[model samples]
Target: MSKYWSEAIQSLTPYVPGEQPKGSNIIKLNTNENPFPPSPMVLEAIHQFDTDRLRLYPDPDASALKLSLAEHFNVKANQVFVGNGSDEVLAHTFMAFFRQPQPLLMPDISYSFYDVYCNLYGIEAKHIPLQDNFCIVLDDYAQANGGIIFANPNAPTGRALTLEKIEALLQRNTETVVVVDEAYVDFGAQTAINLVDKYPNLLVIQTLSKSRSLAGMRVGFAIGSAELIEGLERVKNSFNSYPLDMLAQATAIAAIKDNDYFVETTQQIITMREWTNQQLQSLGFKIIPSKTNFVFASHRYIEAAELMGFLRTNQILVRHFSRPGINNHLRITIGTEAEMQAMIDCLKRHPDIISL
Candidate 1:
């Protein structure tokens, strides 16, 4: 609105994050965050970290953290790239490999941030629509483009594409980079990290926020060929040399090392998601087959916006997008058992909304 603003700033429509209400009684399922606490080892690491280290800059390379991720994922150290979060890593990826001659290809109903990054970097984008069941149709992506990126268990819909399909896309399109955003892969979907070694153009992005329960710490990384890793590093260093601070690096390293804790927590969320799906189905909601930490569902009779408002009035918050093709559905994050039971109780209280 101001003449002082740059052209890019003036034309930008920023991404809207889920609401973080300030209260203890509210059942918050709007944001897809882990409902469990971080591993005990992560807490121990945080306690052991020396506050005096704040005086010095963290290792510019984040060498220790990268090595941990490499060992955990069975990738070489040179093939790993760390950043402030997956969002920042993705931003650097757009600037590095996606700004090519052809427009970038992505799902029409994937993460909203993809479009935001495109606008910010002036990268033209070609949106490929998902199938009727909300699953990605790989055949639609067999075309010329600068690059390709989509969530494995796609956002809002919680539908996952098979690894065979992903590999087939990579096999057919070897010319452009393919970025698979696996932010929720730990929940149930198979990771594409294993194929990174086979395909030089494959880049798999992940975050510790969801399954690892470190959303507050803000840590994310990318695994790919050394060439792609180097490209991301160049963009990262040019933007900010110390993207990962001392505490964040330490916390993330600890989280990665505690494999058992990570598995237990993620498995619990997966189980809860299935139970929640069945419960919603019993109440006449058509729940999508979800492999992530959330479920996408729509009532047979009630409107999504109306149900969203009803839940909010009862101190239960879930996500509802006004976008086309999905405006009738609501995305509900899997909370603790008690919280979910409370939500069910709330639904029971409003029997009028549910079909017999």
Candidate 2:
């Protein structure tokens, strides 16, 4: 540790993103990215971007993108806040609303980023353990806290909470902020965006990375009451005023407007996810009921790490978290139909994997 670094930086643990292999031929299903390419209209918008606009800073407020998102989500423009990515939006959120006298609460096995954000901001976090089935239990979150946050259709496990349950949490926790990170919501779970107006304390965070096929562009947003959004804006302006560049703004606007393309692509991923789940179950894997674009499963005979290695040897990559409680589980992203078939073929060849 360097002495020159700030005390916060010296003690902070950063979030480790999924591996991005450089090889082109490998089948990548580790990160929850859409297998299909982004819409042609998005590419064309990027191409048609005015080069001269780069000379000037983009709108610090990103008015156009915010307007488009507001219209698309049926919210007021003031209620929407855009940032570099959902991670960034979430970071600003933890710093702004989650720090209070009582500790912030989250599911112990939910997105690892929640812990990272807590560490980064010096926010006290009370981690509520997931239910025996790996589901988030709303009752566990009833304890005193500064704020509550968790991924809907949570990461790794991919199990989703119904909108009714989310509303129940909101109904109970009216004093503190409830942040719903819906990065994978478009794939399966119902969004809490509709409830934002009713609950002034509810904040819903979303990303273009998984559903819009814009992970490369790094655009994310939050929908809440204008007051909640203002808090995030304060943190953002203090950090970086021009988080979205000219091209990113142009590309995101086009991507959000291309409703037909986004719907078709996400539907395809959902279809592939169902197929993958069936195939995994047929291979004797104990599958968690997943609503996200990925499946969390463990085989009866094969261990998670060994199964990962076998998939890697076949040039197919899936995610396996080497941590407490879930060391034997694998989180496999739903790739294209062809990629899933190839993965099944590879699994069939491994005798260690028992087919049910």
By TM-score, who's the top model here?
1
Q: Candidate 1: misplaced stretches above 4 Å? A: none
Per-candidate Cα RMSD to the true structure, in Å, reads 0.9, 1.1
Native-vs-model 2 lDDT? 0.92
> In model 1, what is the error at residue 6, expressed in angstroms?
1.2
lDDT by residue for model 1 over 1-356, one digit each (tens)?
A: 88999978999999999999988889999999899999999999999988998999999999999999999999999999999989999999999999999999999998999999999999999999988889899899999899999999899899998999999999999999999999999989999999999999999999999999999999999999999999998898789999999999999999999999999999999999989998999887999999999999999888989889889999999999999999999999999999888887787677565436
User: For every model shown, what is its TM-score relative to the native structure?
Assistant: 0.98, 0.98
lDDT of 2 by residue, 266-294 (tens): 99888888889888888889999888888
Pairs clashing in candidate 1? Answer: none
Candidate 1, position 169, lDDT: 96
